[model samples]
Target: MILIIAKALVKDESLELFKREALELVKNSRGEDGCIEYSVYEDQEKSSVMTFVEKWEDRAAIEKHEGTEFFKEKIGRLISYSENIEITLNSEVL
Candidate 1:
């Protein structure tokens, strides 16, 4: 399995728009094959900080997701509006 933790910092004024876009991304991501889980959440202390927690069956699944048009479009829009973004990938050691 593969896990991805994606973080994005939005401008305070762009928070609402970021939430809406995030919800749409979650909905669409959940429908893709090999997507084990998809969720979006706001940081408790910083409203402008948003994170997406994603689980996939494997690296191939994650790569397939990256190639999807949905990811391309939405991620592009997010990059345009977000102040900062980062993605981290992990896997079980045992």
Candidate 2:
């Protein structure tokens, strides 16, 4: 299994737009075939900080997800609304 953590620092003026796009992303990504789990979380202390936590079957599943049209559209728009973005991929050791 693969775990993906994506964090975004959203621009203050763009929060509403960012939330809308992020919600759509989470909602659609959850329905993908290889998605074991998908969710977006807002930081308790800092609402402008958001993160996406995902579990997938494997690397191939991630590639396939990246190729989807919705993924392309939403991610692009989301990037535009963020001050910075970071993503990390991990494999379960246990």
**Candidate 2: worst-modelled 10 consecutive residues by lDDT:** 25-34
**Tens digits of per-residue lDDT for model 2 on 18-90?**
9999999999999998999999999999999999999999899999999999999999999999999999999
TM-score of each: 0.94, 0.97
Error in Å for residue 44 of model 2 = 0.7
**Reference-based lDDT, residue 53, model 1:** 97
- Model 1 whole-model lDDT (C-alpha atoms): 0.90
| lDDT score of residue 81 within candidate 2 | 99
Judge candidate 1 at residue 8 and give its lDDT: 94
At residue 57, candidate 1 shows an lDDT of 98
Provide the lowest-lDDT 10-residue window in model 1: 12-21
